[model samples]
Target: MGTGTGRKFLFVLGSARRDGNTEQLARLAAEQLGDVEQRWLWLGDVPLADYRDVRYPVSERPEPTGNEELLLDATLEATDIVIASPTYWYSVSSSTKRYLDHWSNWERVPGFVEAMAGKHLWAVTALAEEPHQAGALLDALERAAVYLKMTWRGGLVGVGNRPGDVLSDTTALTTAKTFFTA
Candidate 1:
């Protein structure tokens, strides 16, 4: 459903495995947002190549030739952004990391900084250990929001080691339901 405020959600999932615990938690939480327009970008299915800067004498926009261009377009229309990833070595997955790396290119677009202003950002993660294990990744997301002049709407970290383990985490499920509602 629409939130009257015309909020849109962009959910970028970073887990490489389909139907994994991280994906389960993200879907469970997104369902709570009702029918609000939500764009789901599964990094596993995207070709997010590394960024390569080609210096130009004049200020020229770097052409996006990969999946990150799609993400950028969606972000422009979204009022809320959700970065969901599985913890890998206490950090975000490689796919997620690569996705974030493209921000450098986005920043080069005229008025891109102003366009991101006032947008809200949130995050979700599934950890093999305790939920606290995703702290580093969450912090990086928060920092990015601050840098972009966006609001950090907090995050949800679920404890899950197996495919459906996140389903058993009542704390995470309850927290997810309340994240946007509250």
Candidate 2:
């Protein structure tokens, strides 16, 4: 149960906007990991418009590129993963959504369950506060956590989808770090 300092940690940043609130938090977490052996893969840049076939087609199996497969496979080899995203419209971004839709593929690999049986996962979400707003994104995330069979270390929310909003919010930053550590 001890990840220690040498274990590999993978963080999948899922934001469409570059340097947005969610991306900033992902960067902050990466910086704070401090000597724990980690790698941050920014999948937010993948043009989601091209990912219409998220669940893959029934006629043929989806084959991952070397980099894509590496991210999936590394979950078994890595100590943990942080799935960070901006709560867009009401859930994770299309980029991250597409990636998560590919989760079913892992079951086909040998020893996949035992390999990733108890791996830790954290879902971080940043949402803008609005009139009568609710944690709809968190609800979607909870379902995913249930299906993934991974520990949900919780999330980070903010009223900052606009530029430079979360920058000075001490409470938001504290919330982010608290969930990460918890």
Candidate 3:
């Protein structure tokens, strides 16, 4: 989609460390999305517990922590959503997995399925190894998008074991600029 103020982009970063490689790459990509409103959600700050289907009766209802509600609101408000994470042992980080697991609760929410349909979903991941090392994580995110009926807008994975190492990857930098510019 064209980068314009009319479009809203929500970036959900799932890295455990502050200012980690994943966050840096996600920020770089967001910067390329010119003239658009951007919202950053650090999943590390979100206190997400084990996924519990909250639509159960009051007696069986999960604890009333508002984190899920807040996240869901931000997600539904955005036209484009970026789920960024650091690859952990060939899978997504714990925070990203937990956040995605919560999607099942939305199935109980009225209109949630309809609201998710047709929205755009993008993936961003950073790993010390090659991008291929993160294949499973990418596949999981893509499948989630398909299951939710959202369009998968593709993904970017940068190699950076150390802080700011992604800055040296010209391919990732160029890809972010070109992808968002379009």
Candidate 4:
């Protein structure tokens, strides 16, 4: 609502399966922040193409590309929090992991950490129908958020036919609202 500052979110979707379960969850959470600016980066579309080098080094900084710069800039400008949600595979999806790998350096990007310093980060993972289906994945997300210095807000769990099937669950919708309010 406040264009004057950081009141938006940069959402990174980690499922390559189009319209897959995780994408739907991303959207549901997104829908909560009505009219809020959003940068939805689907890791599937980006495909982890090699770059000259990731400029976010702890010791030195480099100019970032439009995408990288914008992503980092928006992160610096974000007000509420940074949300990374993905479909869990053995652990977190490679797409999500790779996406995070991109954000490894906090020192390079100006104000990046200050913007994200104490903000909350919520992660949602879709898993196969099994016991503790998303355990490893949740663990990965926990460690990632910790390493990134983001406040681990909470987590969500969903299981369904495929990707979008998460929408049908009442818990999914409720969980999204809960995180949004936080």
Candidate 5:
């Protein structure tokens, strides 16, 4: 199952509930990634503090410690990044939003933006409504990838609300089989 390309994938889970529909969908897609290296991080497990807008003061960005450092290292080590977040109010969950906000701080690190450039970004989301309802969530991730000069590999949208509901979405299941292959 090895791709033998030395590609490492970082799957960032942003769901409030463990084993939620969004994470399940992400796992389905990840299984198709073959033997490629994969790491999973749940935002809830590594609680990040609220991002403070320090750009206004033009102060030095302090080094990241604790869970922040762990996440930073993981992001830097990965060749591909998968953001697995559930759609809340037609957008990403609060934890996902907070994780992206931390990117602002990371960008200030020396060569951080350069390291992020050309990396691949993918999105996975489960929405309560139709698949089209994930438009906002996908747009946000796509914009972030564009801003970072990363390749946008599109997204996998699953229709679900309750626990395990996403498994019932045949369309998503079929797409998950080859989502990462592209």
Candidate 6:
């Protein structure tokens, strides 16, 4: 089950609740990635401060600290980035949105954009509504990937509400078995 491809996947879990349907679905898809390195980062655990628009102020922003540093480093080290977030109001969760907002600051770091270019981006989401409800969330991620010059590897969506609900989604489970196969 070893990929031996040196591909590292960074799974950013953006759900408010631990072990929620979104995380479950993401874990299922990740299991298909074989022995490739995987790092799971729960957004709640590494909370980010609200992003500030300092670009126009001629102000110098301090270096990233605490969880911000951790996340930034993990992001740079990974060859693939998986945004694992539940569909909240037809878009990404607040915590997840916050993490993405920090990308603007990261972009200021020398070579950050170059480092991200050509990397793989993927999404995994679960929603109480139909899979189509995740369109906004998927579109945002896909667009961000393109902006970063990363390859969009598509997304996996599962319909579920409560914890463990996605487990009963036979269709999702079947897809999960081969979601990351390619």
Q: Give the per-residue lDDT of model 2 (tens digit) for 1-182.
A: 13465567777888776778776766665565656767667785433234334344543656556655776666667767777788877877878877776666655555765665566776666667651242676676666666667666666666575866766667767665645445
Clash number for every model?
A: 2, 0, 0, 3, 0, 0
- Which run of 10 residues does model 1 get worst, by summed lDDT? 52-61
State the displacement of the C-alpha of residue 55, model 1, in Å, after optimal TM-score superposition: 7.0
- Local distance difference test, candidate 1: 0.83
TM-score per candidate, chains pooled: 0.92, 0.78, 0.91, 0.74, 0.96, 0.96
The order of the candidates by lDDT, greatest first, is 5, 6, 3, 1, 2, 4
| Candidate 6 TM-score, C-alpha based | 0.96
Per-residue CA lDDT of model 3 for 50-91, tens digit only, reads 876676673565533588888888888987889888999999
lDDT tens digits, residues 15-55, model 6? 99999998999998888877899999999999999988555
Clashing pairs in 2: none
The pairs that clash in candidate 4 are: 6-79, 20-163, 21-163
Question: Residues 57-88, candidate 4, lDDT per residue (tens digit)?
Answer: 54555556656665556556655444455545
Q: What is the lDDT of residue 165 in candidate 2?
A: 74
User: Between prediction 1 and prediction 2, which has the larger lDDT?
Assistant: 1
Please give the TM-score that candidate 5 achieves against the real structure. 0.96
Candidate 1, residues 1-182, lDDT tens digits: the string is 45675889888888978878887888888887886888888887886777655434226656665576677787788889888888889988888888787776777766768989899989888998987878898899999999999999888899988889999999999987777767
Best by TM-score: 5
Question: Candidate 5 has which clashing residue pairs, if any?
Answer: none
State each model's CA lDDT, in order: 0.83, 0.65, 0.84, 0.63, 0.92, 0.91
- How far does residue 68 in candidate 6 sit from its true spot (Å)? 0.8
Candidates sorted on TM-score, descending: 5, 6, 1, 3, 2, 4
Q: How many backbone clashes does candidate 4 have?
A: 3
Q: Which stretches of candidate 1 lie over 4 Å from their true place?
A: 1-3, 54-61
What residue pairs are clashing in model 3? none
Best by lDDT: 5
